[model samples]
Target: MPNYWGPFAQLKEQTNAILEVANYNGLMAELNDALFIDRSDIAYYVDLAKEAGGPILELGCGSGRVTLPLLSGGYHVTGVDNSQDMLDILSKRMQHRSREEQSRLTMCREDARNFQLGNAFSLVIFPYCSLLLFTDPADRKSILKSVRRHLTSSGLFAFDAPVQESLNQERIFELDLPIESGKTVVTLGIKTYHEQKVMLENSLFQVAKSTNKRYTILEYKKLALFAEGELEQELQEAGFYVYKRIPTLSDNGKTLRYLYVCGKSDTDTYPLWHPYMPHNQLPNHVLTLVSGQGCRVTDQHGKTYIDASGGLWSVQCGLGNTYIIDAITKQLSTLSYGTLFAGRGNEPALALARKLVELAPYPLEWVYLTGSGSESVELSIKLARQFWHFAGLANKNRIVYLDQSYHGTFFGSMGVSGLYPAKETVGPGLPGLDCINAPNPDNCPPNQDYETYALTCAEQLETVARLKSDQIAAFIIEPVLGSAGVVIPPQAYFDRIAEICQRHNILLIVDEIATGFGRTGAWFCSTHFGIKPDIMLLSKGITSGYLPLGATLFSAEIGNRLLAHGAGIMHGSSHNGNPACCVAALATIDVLTNQQLIKRAREAGHYVRELLEQMKNEQPNVSGIRSLGLMAGVALCQNDHKPATKEQVAVIYELLKRKGVLAYPAVSSVVFFPALTITDDELQTVVQKLGEVLSSVQLVNNGTRMR
Candidate 1:
C-alpha cells in the first residue's frame, strides 16, 4: 500500500473499473439500439443541421444514428468515433446508400479528443449526450480544442449534455424491447451518483425464441456532473462562447439537458504559438496588447507601458502615425495588391524603389524588394551565389558572417545567425558559411586600444579571404550586432573590413535591417562608418513597423552584370513590392525626414548615455553602457564581475514592468530601442525606473551584491 495524505485518499483507488463500452462486443451496440432507439431525437438534430450547413463533422458518431440522417438529408458529413466495431456497423449501413450519397460521407475511427482531419468544417456536432462521455474536465477541454481547430472562421460547434443539477440521485430501471425475428432485448441500468460524477452500469440481455437461448454482456458509462458555471468558464477558456442555449427534457422529463450552440470567440479563439516560445507554455511576462499610440501601448487590462523597445527594434516613427496610416488606406483603395512579377509593376512600388535608390550611397542605383527582412536576407544569399555563378566563378559560393550577428530567421539567414540557439537545433544550414568573432569592446584584450582590437578582429576576415578567396562570394555583417546585445565595434573595424573585401574581390553584404532608417541617427549605419557596401539589406524601420517591407540594394556594377545575364531574376515573392507596403514605406520615410527624427535620435543618444552614466554611478550593477543614436544597451553584472544570470535579469524586468516601463532584455544586458519620436520626459522616466529596479534587485542564491 502507498502512503496517502489527503481527505480524498480513500477515493484514489477503486476496485470497480471504468467501462470500455465503446470497444465492447457487437451485442452491446445492438443493446444500445434497443434501449434508446427512439428515432424521435433525430428530428431535433435535423433541425440543427438545417441551421448549420453542410461539410459537417459529427463527433462520437456511433453506428451512424445521427450521421446517417444528416447524410440522407443532402448534407456532407464526416464521422469520427473511437470504436471500430461501431464504425464497421456504420460502414455496412453506408454501403446500402447510393454511390452519390456515399461519396459525401467520410468515416474515421479515432478519438474525438485528438483527431486531425486536415479539413475545416462549417459545423461540428456532438449529439445525443456524446460530450458527457468524457468525465474528465481535461478531456472535455481537449475535445473542444480539437473542434476549434477543425472549424472554419465562422463555423459553429454544437453539443448536448445533461445539466449537472439533474444528476442528483441514484436510480435503477429495466427495459425490454422486441427486435427483428422473434428476438427480445432487456437492459438493466443501475445509476450510482458521486459528488462530481455519475456512473451507469448496465447488464444487457439478448434472447432468441427459436433456440430458447440468451446471452448477456456488462457495459457501463461514467459522465461528469460539472459544478455550476464550470463548463461555461471552460468553454470561454477554449476560445468559444455559447451563442445560443436551449433547455430540453430527456428520459421523460426526469433529466434536463442543454443544447449549446457555440461560436468561436472573435479574440484569440484558438491559441497562437509565438515565435521562439515553447509550444507547451506561455511566458509569464507576456501581455496581450489592445491598443497603442505615441511611445506607449496599453495591455488588455487597460494598463499602459512606455514602448521603450519600440516593438523588437522596429516602430521607428512611433505607433499610430496618421501619415503612414493614411498612405496605407489610400493605397489599399487605389491598388489593394499588384504583382511585381512578369514585368508588371504598380506606381507605389516603382516610386518606393526610386526613393530607396536616391537615399542609398553611390553606385547603389538599383533595388529589389521583398516582404520582410528574412526574405531579404534569403534573397541576398541567392543573389550573392548567383552573382558569382553568372560571372563564371561558380566556385566562389562561400559566405562569411560575424559572430553575434542576427540576419533573419529563414533557413538561409538562420545559417548565418551568430546566436547558436537560433540555428543550432535546426541545422545544418547553407554550406560554405564561416563565422569570425564580432568586434565587441567588452571582448577586447586587456590594455589594448579599442581601434586596434577592432582592426585585429577585422583582420581575421581578411585571413579567411586570403586562404579561401577563390571560393568566397560575399562577407555579411550587421552595422552593430543588434541581437547580440547591441555590440558596437569601433569605426576603424569597418574601414579595414571594406578595404580587405574590395582587395580580395569579395562582395560586401551589409545587413542594416535593424539599424537602417535612422535607428543609428544616420539614414543608414553603414554611412556612419563610411563603408560603401556592395549590397545593402534593409527592413524593420523601413516602414516603421506600420507594414512589412524589405529591400536589397545592389551596386551599379553588380546590378548591370545581373541584368545583362538576361534570365531576369532567379527569385521573387508573390507580394514583392506590394503597393500598400510600398506606400507605407514612403510615408514612413516622409515622416522621419519631415519631423527631423534622425537628428533627434542623435540628440536622444547623448541624453540617454548621460542618464545611464548617472544611473551607473548610483547603482554598481551596471558594468557597461553602449549606445549609438536611439539604440543602447546597459550591461549588468554581479559584484564578482560575472554577467548577471537569466533569473536575476528576469527579476529586474518584472520590476521594470511593474513600474510601467517596457524594455528588452538581451542576454545579460537590458537594451533600449525607444522610438525616435520619444520625448525627453518619456526617456527619463524609463531610465529612472530601471535604475530603481537595479538598486533594489536581490541577488539570487548566492546573495552577492555589486556594491
Candidate 2:
C-alpha cells in the first residue's frame, strides 16, 4: 500500500489477494518449464556473470528458477521475492543440494522496489517482466535508482520485459505439468487489457481434461511500454547507460522477450552544480576546468584534453584568450550588471547588437538578447506569435519544426520538437505545434536521389502550410542538425524552403546554436545556405563559453510591425543586457575577426575533414563522415550499414577518452565540434587515436573485444 495512484491504482483494484497467494508448491516451477523454459536467459546471465565477475542479486526470483541455475554455474546468488510461499518452496528444494551449493544461495522475501541487501553487487537481474509488477513509472524508477546505488562502478543491471504486442491477447495459451503418474496439473492463461493495464487470468486444473475442479489466479500487471528509442532516453535519465539489448528466447528458440543490459553511468556530481546538462543526467565528473590556452583544457585531475566540443560548441576564440578574459574582467569591475527593462539598456548591449546587425545577412537587422539558447527560442516563438497577433493575424499561432532538430528545452521550444523520446517526459507542449520530416540524406528513400529527397522534404512543409496556412506561424529548422548526429541537409534544401515560406507568408526560422561563431566556415551556418531567415536564433558561441548569452536576429519588418500601435513586446530576461556577457561577446568577436579565425576555421576545418575522410576510407566500420567547418561527425556501423549499437558506441568513446581525446557521443556516431583554433598536430593525434580506437573495438561473440 505505497499510496498507489493513476495507472498503479488501476492494477491494485483489479488484483485479488487469494489469487496472489494461492501460491506455488513446485507446481509453478513445473508449469514454467511446460510453458517455455527460456534457457537462453540462463546462458546470457552466465556469460555476463563471467565477464562482470558477479555476486548476483536476482529480484523477483520466483521458486529459484534462474537462481538455482546460476548457483550451479558457480555464481554467488541472492534471490529476493515478495512471495513467502515461493521462497518456502525454493528453500525446500535447496535442501537436497550440496553444502557448498547451499552456502552460495541466499534468500530474502522482499519487494524489488524497496529491497536492500547491505552490499553492492556486480550484476542485478530482474527477469520475467518483474518490472511490470510496478505499474507506476515512479516506482519503477525507484527500483532502478536502488539498483544503481547497489551496483559496483563497473557492474551491470539487466532486466527482461515481454513486448506489448506479444502479450497473450487471445487467451488460448496453455501449459500442462504432470505431478503423479497419471494425474496432470494444467494451467490455462487468459490475458486481457483494461485501459492499457494487463490482466492474466491463470486457471489451474487437477488434470489436462476439464472437469470443473480449478483454482484461478488473477494476475494484474501494468507496465510502461517503451517507444522505438525511448528506453535509452529513460535509462540515461535514470543514471544508467544501456550498453546492449539481447533477445530472451523461448524453448523453441524464437524471440519471446527482450533484455536490456546497462551499466551505471559515472555521474556522482553531487555537490549540486549541474549548470547546462541537456539530457537531465548528472555530470559524469564534476570537472572544474581549471585553466587553458589555445584549444586544450585541464581538469582538476591534472589531465588535459582537446576542448573538442568547445564546451558545448562555444569558445570560438579558444580557451584562455587573455584579450577576451581581460575584457570580461574589466566589464565585471565596471558596469557589471545592467538590465534592458523599461526602455533602459546598456552601451555594451547596444554596441554588441549594432555589431551583430552589421555582420548579419542584409535581411536580419533587428536583435533580441537572451540568457541561453533555449531562452532565445522562447523569445523567438513569442516574437513570432506576437508579431502576427499585433498585425491582426492572431489565427496564425502554430510553429513547425524539422524532424530530429533540437531547438531548445523551454516548454514552447520543446512543443515544436520532433524527437519525441527526448521530450516525452515533459508535459504536453504548447498547442498547435507541428513538425515535418527533415531532409536527411541517410533517410532518403531507396528510389529517390538526394535532390529529390530534399525537395520532397521541402514539399512536406509546403503541404502542411497549404493545409493549415492560417494556423501556421513559422517553420523552424536547424542549419545543421546537431543532436541528430550532425545531419547536414542537401545544398538546395533551404532555398526551396525559403521560397515555400515566402509564398505562404510564413516566417522561416533557422537555429544556429551549434554552428555559429566560426564553428562553421561561415560566421553563421545560416550564411552557408545563402538564405536570410525571417527569424534567426543564436547562442553557444555568443559569449564563447565565458558567459551565458544568446540572441534572436530577425528582419526589421517584423520588428517594426510588433513595435507598431504602442504594442510593446513583453519578453526579456532579468540579465538580458548584462554588460559582462556583452563585453565577453564583443571581445570574442574581436578575437575571431582580428585573428581571422573564421578563415582559419575554413582552412583547419578542411584539414580535419580530409583526415576524417581518409580514416573513413581505411576503416570497415565507418559508414559516413559529415562536416561543415570544425563541426564534424563520423558514423560507425556494423557490416549491414545500420548505425552502431550502444555497446559499440561506448567501446569507441571509452577508447578515445583513454587516448586523451574527448568527443561528444550520439546514439550511433561520434561527433566533434573542436575549437576552430585546434592545430594540425592535434588533428593528427585525433586521427591516429581514432584509428587505434576503431582497431580496438571489434566486438566478438563472447561479449568482449577481439584480441
Q: Score each candidate by Cα lDDT.
A: 0.79, 0.76
lDDT of 1 by residue, 314-382 (tens): 999999999899989998988899988888999999999999999995469879999889888888889
CA RMSD of all predictions: 19.9, 10.8
lDDT of 1: 0.79
RMSD of 1: 19.9
Quality of model 2 by C-alpha lDDT:
0.76
Over the stretch 1-707, how does candidate 2's per-residue lDDT look in tens digits? 12333333454577553235345455545545444463467667766675566699999888777888788888899889888888888898899888999999889988778777889998999887677667677787888888888898768898876655555543444555543223344434545454555444344444332444344333333455554455577678788886677877553655657788888876655546463454334444335578788788787677887767777778788888899989999988988899999878899999999998987865687998899988888888888998888778999988998877777778877776565355656556688787888876667777988888988888998899889968888888888887777888876888888888888888888888788888888888877778778888888987788899999899988888966767766787799979999998999899888989899889988998899999889887787888888888888777666667766776677667657787877646788888878889998888888887787555443232422
Model 2, residue pairs in steric clash: none
After superposing candidate 1 on the true structure, give the runs of residues whose Cα lies further than 4 Å from its correct spot. 1-270, 283-285, 420-422, 698-707
Please give me the total number of clashing residue pairs in predicted model 1.
0
TM-score of 1: 0.62
- With candidate 1 superimposed using the best TM-score fit, by how many Å does residue 74's alpha carbon deviate from the native? 70
TM-score of each: 0.62, 0.66
